[model samples]
Target: MARSARPVVHYMATRPDGTVPPTCNHLARYYSGLGETIPTVNLADHIGETVDHPSPGEKWYTDKPFSYFHMYTRPGEILERLEVEERWPVRLWEVEPLGETGNWGNDFAPYWLMSHQIRVVREVEAWRAFGHRGMQVLATLAQLPDLARQWTEEWTADPEGTRRTYTAWEKRVDHTRALTGWAFCRAQYSRREAGLQAANELAGNAAAQAATAAGADPHAVALIQLRARCLVAGQLMFDRIRTGEYEQSIRGLLLGAGLETPAPALA
Candidate 1:
């Protein structure tokens, strides 16, 4: 019998920086020097749009969305294979994992990508895991426009009352694109919250019972778990900062939006 394809993980390869992102050799070849132009037509392509006749070259088409299809190896499989091969062995659970080619020297691609802007497509349940942390997922959408402006001057060239000029058309197009991303982000954000809440309640109850059985203070036990979680998460953020992925991602986002070069980080 034929085997089904491995589940793909999705991520935005374009960083806020204009330079090529450091990733696996395969994905690097796929998206190097790539620029994503603001999509003109909606994905459905059924809805009609106002036309301002922008040049074709002005709109760049990137295959970043499609590149996920080519990815086949998962973190577990990559780690197992690498360990057996005795090349760049890494603890699957300890090291951050990103989806990438299962080759030596590129072992760090997945972790770096995950730290910067990678998203796993499979293991849909993982969203629940993040929710327990009480993370504000909606903030990414909330910050898009500000990110755009920080990246590009042309992002705000046209006000609502501006005539049907090229600049105005571009602004309108960007607004629509931003709205689409916002909608998707909002849905995921809601799902993550609901999932996190449910998962935490279940775990908290279990922890409380276990603690009570051991004649321990259940409340104190729960508090300790929460404290430990915060510390671990904070450490991960610190690691991202130290590795420069945090700054690189911010720059990549700015570039992807076609706003301008060298966007400033939010203080």
Candidate 2:
């Protein structure tokens, strides 16, 4: 549905502890007139396209959108699922840098996303009209595992299970795999703080090469910041095997990766 060219009011999602008066009777008032499930892109072009694959000849620069896209599956099909909300939810990835990598921001615009879904609603009416246009938008959101699996299958010149593993590093890394593993470990283990810290440290090291470097980009800073914020993910993991706080996850990684879990301090 073409927006009436009228102004629109958008709101940041409601927070965990914040409260908002539910006075806005029509929560979906903006999209009231528009069709449901508006396809922001060309639908016919995406037909028969693998929602999990990328378009050929289309180069993705390691910028915002494309960079964000690589961490998961094909962006085109993702938009399709998004049009229908069929996407499997997964952890959010950090925005990739532009410069020498690729100019993904202009084309992909991944930073605009919230969660696995492109969350900004286009007014209920807009969706209503979108629905009218023969768009088959599913209202349900995709599950996390579905999205995570898509991430686990990242494309690369690296050998099998090399880039696929939870360890081996990449400049702009896949955040979901580490995050999923961390979430699982945290849930299974009794040490909440220990797990979160270790997981964060792992994520930090994977995201960037430095921690306190003064000339880091936002892409790099985000990782450095994550490392600092989470306290000690690598340390926690290291401490555990060394002192046995909870050795299952570490031991699992050791055996799983075929790489010894460094009982020594985490790098």
How does each model score on lDDT? 0.28, 0.28
Model 2, residue 175: what's the lDDT?
Answer: 36
Q: Per-residue CA lDDT of candidate 1, range 137-217, in tens?
A: 223323333332332223234322222232332353345442223222332333332222232233334434443444434
Q: If scored against the real structure, what TM-score would every candidate get?
A: 0.19, 0.20
Model 2 accuracy (lDDT, Cα): 0.28
lDDT of 1 at 251: 25
Error of 1 at 111 (Å): 28
Off by over 4 Å in 2: 1-176, 182-188, 193-213, 226-231, 239-267
Task: Give the per-residue lDDT of model 2 (tens digit) for 1-267.
Answer: 865765422212111222111112233233344543211222123223322212112344222221122221212122122211111221112122222223346445331322211222221221121112101211111122232223322312222443223233322123333334553364234223322433333334433433223344454345333323222333333333433533544433422322212222335
TM-score of 2: 0.20
Q: Which 10 residues in a row give candidate 1 its minimum summed lDDT?
A: 87-96
Please name the candidate that would achieve the greatest TM-score relative to the true structure.
2
